[model samples]
Target: MVRSILIFVITYALFLISGFLFQIDQSWYDALNKPAWTPAGGTIGMIWSILFACIAASITIIDRKAGGLNNLKPAFWIILIVNYLSNQLFSFFQFSQKNLGLATIDCAIVAISAIILTVFALNIRKIAGILLVPYVLWTSFATFLSFMFYSMNL
Candidate 1:
């Protein structure tokens, strides 16, 4: 019980770190020309937080189902870590250098991670599958936004 809670908390913290890394909300991002439909920062944050919660729950459920970390879903775990690191890299690198090209790819990976997690969640746990829905949808939106950002900035 405690472990599960810890896992969720740690995972959420990792996501929070990714969000703030390299000062992603800095002036440069604000200065960039964005689509008229781009969401405000508060909305983006709220959406991301909800998505991250889903992801954390999914991870907890899936990991628990996989023989309590013994026969553990190695692939699922790896992909999740990759997804988190990619997200952090995107936020940090894209903001620091304003690298939209990489951000585009990074955002795609985020969506891909959500998809992978969703599929694995279906096999491992239903709660897990449901948990990733928000991430998949939201990250898909983020991917589209990233492409627009790249197109406009370039």
Candidate 2:
């Protein structure tokens, strides 16, 4: 159980660290002709960092209760992977070369992945379900932001 949680924490830490490696300057982002309502990069980063932490903690609790890796459900693994990957990919789409279209699609994917992960997490642990609440909410908000960005930019 503790082992399972450990894995989630470690993976999440790496995910975060990887993000920090890419330096997206605020000035650069601002210089780009963004839509009127796009959030400041720091604000978005902080929110995502917090949400990712919560998700890490939530899955850890579930992992502990589930009696370690073998007992952990496949859906749990898949959704987590998808969520993490989508999160990582969005940075690429949003920051690298500034592709609003790809960013919108990736953000939507993250939102859907959150929904699926939340559902699967619920089946494994109620706390896990509750844990995903912030993630789900933010992702939904991001979807709107992305959609708006796409519409405005395109």
Candidate 3:
């Protein structure tokens, strides 16, 4: 039980660290042409917090179900880590570098990774897969938004 809690805490911490490291330049972002449907700044943060919590919970469940990370297949670890990193990279591309094209591509990869992770999680536990649905949906929407931003800004 303690180990599961540690996994959740660690995963959540990594997400928070990633966010802290790659922050948006609000002034620059405000200048960009965004869709009417784009979420407000506070809403984006709230959404991410909820999504990150879900991710942590999912990871904890998976770790517990699989009897720890060591027992799981290497592919599972690869998918999880890759998904996390790619998701973070979207922020780097969009906010840090202000490269909409690369951000769009990053979002597309994140969306795909979410789907892959969800499918893999389903094989392990149903709830684990279900938890990833929001992440997948959000990334898909972000991909579309990124593409729109790229098209309009270019």
Candidate 4:
């Protein structure tokens, strides 16, 4: 149980590093012509926090079921790393670079890779895959939001 808790904390912290590194440009973001349905910054942040927890849980489940992280297949590691990198890149593209188009593309990659990761996870552990459902749904929503931002700003 202690090991599982450690895994969750470490994974979640890794996910959050992107947010810390590439914070939202509040002034510029606030000036954008966002859709009426756009969520508040606080709401988005909360949602991400929840989603990251889910992701961490999913990883921990997979790691436990596979005996250990090192025991997991190379393919699983590849997909997981790809998803993590793409997910982190979204903040850089959207906030740091202030490139909505790149952000939109990055979101699409995040969504697609998340689906792949979930599927791969299901093959290893059903509960692990199930834990990722919210992450998948949220990333899909975020992809649409990114596209909206791109189009609205352009």
What lDDT is reached at residue 16 by model 2?
A: 87
Clash pairs (backbone) in predicted model 1: none
By TM-score, how accurate is candidate 3? 0.96
Report every candidate's CA lDDT.
0.82, 0.79, 0.89, 0.93
Where model 3 places Cα greater than 4 Å from the true spot, the runs are: none
Off by over 4 Å in 2: 1-5, 33-37
User: Candidate 1's error at 54, in angstroms?
Assistant: 1.1
Q: Over 4 Å off in model 4, which ranges?
A: none
TM-score of 2: 0.85
RMSD of each predicted structure = 1.5, 2.3, 0.9, 0.8
Candidate 1 per-residue lDDT over residues 22-99, each given as its tens digit: 776557788988999999989988988887788788777766887565566579779877788887777865787678
How many pairs of residues collide in model 4?
0
Model 3 lDDT-worst window of ten: 15-24
- Tens digits of per-residue lDDT, candidate 2, 20-127, equal 755566676666665677787779879878887888877677767787646876767887788888888887877775787898899999999999988888888898
lDDT of 3 by residue, 1-154 (tens): 7898899999888887757888889899999998889899899889989998889989899988998878989898898888888888888888889999999998899899899999988899999999989999998998998899999899
Q: Of the candidates shown, which would achieve the greatest lDDT relative to the real structure?
A: 4
Which digits, one per residue and each the tens of the lDDT, describe model 4 over residues 106-148? 9999999999999998888999999898889999999999999
